[model samples]
Target: SQKTNIKALLASDAIGSTVTVRGWVRTKRESKNVAFIALNDGSTIHNLQVVADTAKFDENTLRNVTTGACICAVGLLVESAGSGQRVEIQAESIEIYGVSDPEKYPLQPKEHSLEFLREIAHLRPRTNTFGAILRIRHALAYAIHKYFNDNGFYYLHSPIITGADAEGAGEMFRVTTLDAKNPPLDETGSVDFKQDFFGRKTNLTVSGQLQGELGAMALSKVYTFGPTFRAENSNTARHLAEFWMIEPEVAFNDLDDNMELAEDFLKYLINYALTHCADDLAFLDARFRKEEDKKKKEERAELGLLDRLNFVVANPFERLTYTEAVEILIKSKPAQKKQFQYEVNWGTDLQSEHERYLVEKHFKKPVILTNYPTHIKAFYMKQNEDGKTVRAMDVLFPGIGEIIGGSQREENYEKLMARVKEVGIHEEEIWWYLETRKYGTAPHAGFGLGFERLVLFVTGMGNIRDVIPFPRTPQNADF
Candidate 1:
């Protein structure tokens, strides 16, 4: 019995040959004499059409092959008599492996809203939208590893549980074995972390950049692909309590080199998706256009999914200093009309609105904003000659504001220590990190890319939770 998946059978030249296929039923329509079943195996977004004669199977067997039911169909592949699909399976024999009751099945033939799908996360993958997103997600991740490996970068696995808060934001999920109701208390009447499993305090790592930098220092170039956690209680569409991050660190690379690396890496990922996931991308492109059609005329986007991806890949990203961006935003009509929620200033951090304006409105392309004010940036960033600014860069895309944030690291021991002390970050916590600067520290740079954000951007999904399989938001942790 030569069994074949729907995807392979659809693509094969053996159209006149018989093959056995297994998949879940997406929809089934019955005529007086024949039944047409749409079957999806999760190998592709498009379903394989199966035509079964009522005379070939018992009535009870025909009744069991409903939506969401599992079945094995032995059929001959032939050119489709239908309009939409290229091929269809003419079933000679059929077996119902599992029957799905039509009344209890959550998924139906009708298109369900994304909001409704989120409630049934377990079964959402059976839908076309999520299946396409997941396929693209896998392709993108594979492309990332291939690009890094081909570029002489080593894959570095960083610790998920780290003692040091890399971002210094103090927003971390504590990984503790201590009792929640009544933990060990010190003389200060506080819950003592010293008595915990790891001896001292520990929490989930917010970013692997610090550990990635350490690997780069020894191995020249390294990249980390791992899950990261944050305890931030924000319930926005973009914020996630736990998420995966891609961080690449390179030694002997300055801010300019860092920008080039990030740009090339992102382009590779986009191009890879286009080449490998053509069918899925096409499906998503059509889906995006339909979504756009529903929007008000003025609210719709300028470019569709494919055009946007091609535009980003073909064009060079606009480069400008953060100071220049702030200056331009300050002089823009939004600021003049008092339309901005957050006021634009020289030293203040740029909000999502300001970044979007610079990217989507002003630049009309991907823009790299460099040399940010030191006070607003991380402590490890190299201090610029201006004393007030640091060598930092943020890659802002058209719809997704800041996709990447990176900087040339400070190799100077004293300067790094001073910045650490200035920021009130305890030096003892990062003593090993300081030692790298003291001994044979070269000018290094790295950046962190939120994987979910990238997935959201590529899949044209509105919410970050939709791209990730099982989202961990502030209040919701359901699988």
Candidate 2:
């Protein structure tokens, strides 16, 4: 008989039917007459209990079926006598594919810390915590594609390596084929990129929005979901050297339309998690509460994980302009009491603390702040009539300050070029982007949702690294 996954077997009603199951051993307990083997195949959080009669199997084989060992069991599925699970397997024969020495297996049966698991990322998936997280991550990715496809958006494949700095941050991982020791150099003593593989300087792309906009211009609606890199040296829990970004560009969308799209898109994802990933969400919610309990009384979340997710989906995000948000923050208790580490100032970028104050303390829900200062925003954002602010928007979540950042793109060629010059970005570097405005520009808007950040919020994982499989941080890139 073909092998049945633990997830299917757990939900199955085929009592008394013989089934073959293959998975890594989670745990094994022995009595004089019988032994119980807990097995998991990464299909679900729950493990299948395989009841084995010690008299029927070889003693050596049974001894080898320790934790982390891979085994195949031929058994009869029956209603479990245990309380936690519905069904279990009565093993007739056991075949060991691989044996893990009990003395050497690092993952002994116990609650392991998230930091310790990060060190052994290769085996962390076998754990319930990571298994649930990865499953939800897959579900969210599926929902993202499904939602976009259902809403008439084409998935665009943007290049990973590019020459232009889309965000104008100038922090990029340079891609080159030249010898690092001593290579081509110009008379100016600068390492000449003209002789490089691409014949010009290039780096790993920071965002696909610039290329995504090109697709949107033609396709009317397009989104790019791919890996992006940043060369920032910051080693904070929130920042990653490499991460995934979901950027959607829509033609003829203004700031309000952009805000609406962002709000609806976020709610859809959170709702999908609540509906399709209930088991995983329940597990994570318990984990989230434990973490919450560790915090100081004042710092604990007002709503639990599920409550927070439901609140976002059921309520409309409070919308305000950047100027208005600054005013609120200025008069707020945190700012007045000098609690905020960064001072709240007009015409300046809002830090994560300020954003959290607005979303968590003031609004008590998701908030969308719009019309940010032009100098503080990207050059692509549409310039407003006030001349001080651009048609930019950022969606702030309860725990995560800014989950999504987007704006109505600047459609006027002259204005865009002026901003480009003002920002000191060479016209030749983004000549193609500028040409789009000159020829057939329409009011288009888009936003980037950090894929890991979304997963962190959904999984209620504290560190951004915990959500991603193999995180690339400042000095670490282990498997």
Best candidate, TM-score: 2
lDDT of 1 at 206: 95
Model 2 residue 438 CA deviation in Å: 1.3
For candidate 2, list the clashing residue pairs, or say none.
Answer: none
lDDT of 1 by residue, 265-363 (tens): 998898998899989999999998999899998668789989999999999999999899988998898434376788889999998888988887788
Clashing pairs in 1: none
Write one digit per residue (lDDT tens) for candidate 2, span 308-414: 89988999999999999999988887434386888778987998888988888888988999999999888898999998999999989888888999999999999
| Model 1 worst lDDT window (10 residues) | 333-342
Give TM per candidate. 0.98, 0.99
lDDT of residue 225 for candidate 2: 98
- Cα lDDT of candidate 2 equals 0.92
